[model samples]
Target: MLITDDDEGDRRLVARALKEGHLSCECVEATSIEEAIFACSEYAFDCAIIDYRLPGRDGLDGIASLHQRFPYMSIIMATGQGDANVATEAMKLGASDYIAKAQITGGSIRRIIENALEKAAMRRKLALQQEELENFAAVLVHDLKAPITSVRAFAVLMEHSVGAEITDKDKLIGQCRRVANAARRMDDLIDTVREYTRADGQLLSGPVEMDRVIEDTLSNLHQMLLLRGARVTHGRLPFVLGNASQLAQLLQNLVGNGIKYCEAAIPTVHVEANPDENGAWVFAVKDNGIGISEGYYQQVFQPFKRLHDKSKYEGTGLGLATCKKIVERHGGRIWCASADNQGTTFFFELPACPAIA
Candidate 1:
């Protein structure tokens, strides 16, 4: 920890309080903003307890400079002055917490430090979640607009054709087909968006049976599976600690990818599970179908990233991304490996759950 104070007596008092509080921390002392900056540059401190009034510069300036250099470091402002405005200004300048030097005691210092650390952790978590939401919204807007525009353009063309003297049966049929296709595209986009939003990382606390999840996912897409003439086989699977619904969604996306991205006349999908070196359950979904290119392996996991044309494959490009989000929420990871026309294999690892006694 870094402690910044110009007064020798005040620094000694704070150190004594910390010792009495049993807060075992390795502290480095700095008397001014420049010293504080130099100390921070040399070492990473968990938290900085800084005096708001220094010899040369305002304490708020120190807080701002430290914040720029160590964005994730927690800082608490300690000032003898009881001015409420000073505390507010210090906080606005990036102080994580504030304390009055007059009120400094072993008990109060301990509580303040604990509370400041907790708040800092919460702030970081919330920021990460907010960033994810923003990215999801941006992708949703960019991807959803294309289908909407297509639907509108098709609708306008149909309206104009109805009023025109072009009575050719083939032209009329083509116009109607275009409108129908556009409407279906819009419907698919809306459905995919709804699914993506539904998987909002709200994982439940329980043991999820992967065997049941896989079976249910296959059942849900039974019609599609049959239409594609795909044969899916699975070995004995394991249970994992996570939400059942989310696990099912993850399996469904992998299975669907296997069935859809096929070059074989009859697609073959194999679902297998094994234990990794870390004892995690590594589930692999292998498909004898058209494979993804090496260059686009990582890109395929990004939202709204379509390696193939929408004309050939019907998807909103959120399937893999949703899989990734769900797995991560369950404290797991999902990835794919494939080469062009060599088929594809998707592997996801989840925390292993011991068998119920």
Candidate 2:
């Protein structure tokens, strides 16, 4: 390990302290960023302790340079206790830990260094797991496309082969259509799960107009809406950051649930957004349908967890799960507020908009 500071005396003092504290860390003194890089090229190090105030270069600048070359190396920033902003910036710049220069004794410094090393190890393990999951998802999704394509091809052929003049043609065609829909649902569930479980996550979020997203989702569900006489209304809305496809899917799940569970009355769904106390945007999907029980709220978010039997609801149970993932990925939280028959409101919150365009 290397410890760099503009003060020669401080470097020696820290090195001696660490050595006495049973740390086998080989201390390298670099008063400037250039010296730090030179030391790194000259010898290998598991970590680097950078002082916030360095001559000719700030600690964060040196850390940035070091990170580009040695991303695996743990970085611990030394800062004055009063400089909270500097410490926060260092952490955001990927520093493993921040130590208050005045408060850190020799022993405390060693402990910090050890803790940083442990964190680095855990991060590496997470990276490996993420890679494995990505590889698995890519293969699984790609493999699924082949069989689904064949099934769809055969289904279309059957539809054409059976003439409309034949009796029971409508019934037979509807049954085949149902099978095709089921296959498509499976594909959608697999793709959504694959995207959600990603380690770095699906960074597909972009500027999404509120009205456009809801309009598009509802348009796609036009047949179902018409069949159930579901009315969806909205008012003036704000543009938010989100992925259009994922947003449409999330909406489809919530609104579609309302349509599927509606009793004798026409299904009514509404979408709206407002600002919360934290200044973040809060969106809620309200539905007038068979409402979910309070005890099932938590369970609904789990993949394939259904409150009603498959015969009654007619779902694969991945819709709400996908919604949960999408909301969480956007730095938001979602929960259901509802009473049976009265209605259900699924509310979700997204972080405050970026200050800049």
Candidate 3:
């Protein structure tokens, strides 16, 4: 916490009150708003208390400046008695709460500080959710445009061919197939969006044997593997605490991408896991395929962010994003390492399952 009051006596009084309240907080003092802003830049303080009267600027100015720079920090304005209007203005300037200097007490200050912190946390969470919703909406609209247009164009062509007496059977049939494929692509995109949304939900947690996850994933991709002549091999894997179905999806996506993006005659992918120094299981899915550039390492994990043209590689581009969400939900992280023309390896770490009693 930070206290900004030009009056040394008032600063000491607030500090003393906090001490008397037995609050577990480290207080930093600043004589002016400038000093307070400097202190905040140096460290991350959860809350700040600013006196209404300052050297050159009032607390409202400080509140506005601090709030603009650090929206996540909780700010409280301290005003003199009968400063109700000032308090209201302070709040409009982004002050979380206001306290009258004369009313400052151990109990009152503690309650006010607690409320401010809670409000700050709630504000941050709401902001993040709003950003996510906006991003999802943008991605959906942008990606659906091409497929939707294709469906409409092909449907029109098929309709005209059916009306023509001299229509070629093969041409009409090809148009109908094009329409069906476009519709299928649209359906696939919607399904991918649904899966991505579900990845953000509560995980149904349990011990998941990674070997079985690989078995199921490979089974799911059996046809793709045979068609591409891809080879997938894995060593013994450890058990992890996560959703079994999501883990399987994660691996399936990685393995499928390895085969889909390869230039090799026979793509090869290997999956393995080992214990890290942090007591987490680090799993790696390595592939021998046309590799990713260093520049696209982070971009690959963003939804609807495609590194290749859809004409060459068909996908909604949400696979790696879904993988990232699944790993994060399991209290882990995922990243990749690759060089151009060299194979890529995706590594994710999840909490190891606890030993049974």
Pairwise lDDT winner, candidates 1 and 3 = 3
| Candidate 1 structure quality by residue, lDDT tens digits, 1-357 | 888999988898889889999999998999999999999889988899999889888799999999888877899999986778988988898888899999999999899988888877888889888887798789888776876787688778877888886788788788778878778877888888777777774666587888898899989989988898889999989887778887888889888888888878998899999989987888999998889888998888887888989889888899998898888887788888898899999998888876641
Q: lDDT by residue for model 2 over 271-352, one digit each (tens)? A: 8888888877888888888888888889888655678875577665556877887887788888999887778999998665
Arrange candidates, best lDDT first: 3, 1, 2
User: Where does candidate 3 clash, by residue pair?
Assistant: none
Which candidate number maximizes lDDT? 3
lDDT of each: 0.86, 0.78, 0.91
Off by over 4 Å in 1: 7-29, 38-46, 68-71, 80-85, 100-111, 276-280, 289-299, 338-341, 352-357
The reply for model 3, stretches above 4 Å from the true place, is: 12-46, 55-57, 79-92, 97-121
Clashing pairs in 1: 263-290
Cα distance off (Å), candidate 3, residue 335:
0.7
lDDT of 1 at 205: 58
* Cα RMSD, each candidate: 3.5, 13.0, 3.3
Please give the RMSD of candidate 2 to the true structure: 13.0
On the 0 to 100 scale, the lDDT of residue 337 in model 3 is 98
Backbone clashes in model 3: 0
